[model samples]
Every structure is written in structure tokens, then in C-alpha cells.
Target: MHLAHYLGLLHRSQANLASAFREVAAAHADEPDIEHLCLRQAAICDTHAERLHPFAERYAEEAPREPDRLHSTLFSGTRTGGIALLRDLQDLYLMASECDICWTVIGQAAYGARDRDLLATVRDGEGETAAQLTWLRSRMKQAAPQALVVAD
Candidate 1:
């Protein structure tokens, strides 16, 4: 597929992932730590979505939306049965993984593009997401094991 197509896909995926985090945060808002991290993740996803908007428009592609319950059901059902801290940790890790995928795709696009501005933007975004993922992973490690939520 073309670079624009790939970018569109990335944008949609990030949006859905962000939506999931928002849900998790809302579901466990009683916990400050979970709420804070989920809010941060939602903000990042919003930024990423905005960045991808122009590309989607330029390519005449529809951006991806948050999946409905049917889509989420394929994964683990709503993350419950865990301490608030662990639930947030799990959500963040999932978000990190989604961000990593976006980074990889954007990095590939940067390599293929001749446009310096586009390349630079994609590369920078990729780097930012990678750094965020690293930070989240580190925090996950430091948190209590029981706080880490995992989905099959």
C-alpha cells in the first residue's frame, strides 16, 4: 500500500487504542494513578490522531474510529478484577504496544518518503512514541506485580 494508506491505518489504530485507555480510565477513576496515566495516554493518542488527520484528508481516506464492544470483545472483556494500579498498568502496556506498532509503520514510511518535511514529522513522532513506550514499560516494572493486568 501507499504511504498515505499506511499512515491512515496507523492513525485509526492509535485512535482506537486511545479510546480503549479512556474507557479503562473511566472505569477505574477512583484510582489517581490509573486516572492520570490513562488521561496522559488519551492525550497522546489525540495528538497522534491530529497529526494523522492531514494525511488522511490528503489521501481521501476515512480515519479509524474506536471499535465498538464487538471489536473489544475479541480481546479481553473489560479489565476488571484487578487493583486500580494494576489495571492502569495493564492498560498503559497495551497502549505502549499499540504505539510501538504505529512507530514502526511511521518509521518505515519515513524511510520510503522523499519529502523532507513529511519524513521529519513521521520520524519525530515515531521517536516520541518509542520514548513514551519505554517510560511506560519502566513504570510497569516498578509497580507491584499484582498491579500489572494482562489480557489474552
Candidate 2:
């Protein structure tokens, strides 16, 4: 497949993932901690989609489409109990990792084509996403319940 096709896929996947997170966030909105984290994560995904939209328009043969399978799988995976919360956080981490992979591939392709503008834009977006992931990690750490101390 062409680079544009791959980038478009990534963009759609990011958007779909964000939408799934938003759904989960809405479900858990009463829980302030989880809700805040989910909202932040949803914002990051929205930002990623926005950043990739221009590239998709310029490079792709058509507009990006939603990644239905990924979205469905993510939603199904998070449809449980406390397990869902943990799964949601894990999914966010996985999505962030995928974003890094996509950025690396796109950046390499842009460098090979001598496309400085694309490279710069993708790199900046990647950096922001990475930072957001770091923030999410910190939030996850905070959200994790402390282990009970056992009596000897």
C-alpha cells in the first residue's frame, strides 16, 4: 500500500480509539479520577486526528475513514467491571505506542522523500503525543489503588 494509505489508516485508527475512550469516559463520568483521565486521553486522540487530517487531505486519494474493527474491539475489551478501567488504561498505553510507531514510519518516509514540511509537522505531533502519553502514565500511576498492608 502507499504511504498515504498507511497514514490515513493510522489517522482513522487514532480517531476511533479516541472515540472509544470517550465512550468509556462517559460511562464512568461519575468517577472523577477515571473520568478526568479518560477525558484527557480523548483530547489527545482528537489532537492526533486533527494533526493528521491535513496530511491525509494532501496525500491520500480520499478522505480518511473510521477504523471500525479497532474501535469495536477496544469497546468490547473495556465492557467489564474494575477490569474495564485497567483495560482502558492499558488500551491508552497501547494506542500511544502505536502512535509512536506510526510517527517513526511516517517520519522515515518523509525524510526519504525530502519532504521537510511533512517531517516537521509529523515530528511535532509525535512529540506532543509522546508527552501526553507520559502525562497519562503519571495519571495512571496516581489512579492505581494502593496495596493493603498485611498484618504479620
Candidate 3:
């Protein structure tokens, strides 16, 4: 059914998030914590996508053609300086939030379909996604003071 469409959406979104993480990590390499955490989160996104692949393929046979414009770009690229770091983290927060919601929806679908494997994957991924959001939020809060208030 429409589950395939969402599976595809989540898959692509995970890939996009991973790439954006790597890009931001590299762009802000000066910030060691940001770089390390971004890299770790990128790996987590990759694992989530890998887990979803078999399910996406299995349901595709029953799924209608995917809808157009199902995907949106959240992070174009990273920018420079303190404020830019905050903005980039905000972009990541938005992207991770998308993945978080998708995981919830898909988890519900898995429960309906009686798919234990998918449910477990969703549960695990959702927790990690939540952690990513938390870290992003905290980092943004830390950056805001310097980015918005303190002089260069």
C-alpha cells in the first residue's frame, strides 16, 4: 500500500541526512566535538537505511508508484563562522526530526503489518534519532550565545 511510499521516503531521507552530516562535519572540522558527533550520527543514519532496505523492496510489489516531490533538501551545505555553525546545526535538527517522525509512522505500520523485524529496527533507529536531535539542540543552545551575542 502507501507504506512503500513512506519506506522509500524514509530511506532517501536517511541517506540525505548521512550525507549532510558528513558535509557539515568536514566544513566545521575546526570544531572537534561537532566533527566527531556528526560523523557518528552519519554512521547511525547509514545503519538505519540499511535496515529499511529489505522491507522497502518487499513492500514495493504492493505499493503504487511513488508520489512526486516526496523529498526535500534540508541541508544544502555548511557555512562559515559561529552563527553559520548554529544555522547548520539547526538544519541538521530539522532533518533528524523528519527521520524521527518517519520512524514513528513506520513503526506503527510495522505493528499493523505484524512485522517484528521492522518494528525492532524502527524502535532502535527512533531512539538514536531522538538522541541526535537532543545533541543538536544542546549544541545550538551552546553556540547561540557566541553566535548571536558576543563580538567576533
Candidate 4:
């Protein structure tokens, strides 16, 4: 079943978001609130990843066990926040976007195949990532002004 492909994507998002969350937390350490939030989101991603692991095996399809190649999230900030923090935040937003897309893909596949279990799992994971993305976007809006204002 193509469920393997979907599961692979879910795992990839887990890995990327987990990495992004930790690194973004450290990269934007000046913002203690964001740092704490990323750390918390990372924990949630990890938990969901673990829960989805068993399903991957159950729906094994001999496909490659990786999807980061399809959608890379390995972001080493390009716009170094002051500027650095802003860039990292943008990357986190991108990752969150990817997470949303991945969840949507997984949901469509599972539901189309009438796999209720997979659909439910993906839905729950989607909610967690959505919360993280919503928070990140709100924080980004708050920080953009300070980041753009260059002082003499």
C-alpha cells in the first residue's frame, strides 16, 4: 500500500520538526518564550512520531523509509536576529507549513483507502503541529518590527 509513503512523510516531518524545534529554540534563545514553545512542540512531535512508527510497519510497502529527500527541511539560517532570530523564525514557519502539507497528504491517502485508524492518527498529529505553527506565526508578527528596524 502507498500508506508506506505517507508514513514515511510523517516520520520525515517528525525528524525535521524535531530538529528545527531544538535548533530554533537555541538559535533564537534571546526570545525565551519562543525557545520554551519550540522545546514543547518538539516534545509533541517526538511523541507523535513514536506513535506513528508502529503503523509504518503494519503498512509496510517496500518503499524507501525516508521522505526528507522529497521535502527537505534542513535549514541552516541564511539571513543571519536580531536578523538571525527573524530568519530562524521564518524557517520554523516554513517547517510548520510543510508539516501541514504532510498531514493533509497523509489524511487524504488514509481516508481514500478507508483506513480510519491512520486518518485519526494523522488528524491528532495535525492538531498538535497546527498549534505550534499558529504560535510561531503570531510570534513572528510580533518580532518582525524589531528585526527590520536598523539602529545606528
State candidate 3's TM-score.
0.90
Worst 10-residue lDDT window, candidate 3: 61-70
Give the residue spans of candidate 2 off by over 4 A: 61-67, 77-80, 146-152
Residue clash pairs of candidate 1:
86-147
* Candidate 4 TM-score to native: 0.85
**Tens digits of per-residue lDDT for model 2 on 15-128?**
876776687687767667767777777787788788778778778634344466656665664455554555566666766676677788888888887878789878886887
**RMSD per model, one decimal:** 4.4, 3.8, 2.9, 2.6
Q: Please provide TM-scores, in order, for all candidate models, with all chains considered together.
A: 0.72, 0.77, 0.90, 0.85
The window of 10 residues in a row where model 1 has the poorest summed lDDT is 62-71
lDDT of each: 0.65, 0.70, 0.83, 0.75
Candidate 3: tens digits of C-alpha lDDT, residues 1-152: 78887898788878888988898899898986978989999999999989888998888823322211222354544577658888888888888888888899999999999999889989998999999999999999999999999877
Using TM-score as the measure, which candidate wins? 3
Q: Across residues 28-141, which tens digit of lDDT does each residue of candidate 4 receive?
A: 666669778889888988988887887778887334544455234347443342767767777777777776887888889888889888888888988988888888888888
Model 4: number of clashes? 2
Model 2, position 109: C-alpha lDDT score = 86
Model 3 alpha-carbon drift over 4 Å, by segment: 61-73
Clashing pairs for model 2 are: none
lDDT top scorer: 3
lDDT of 3 at 4: 82
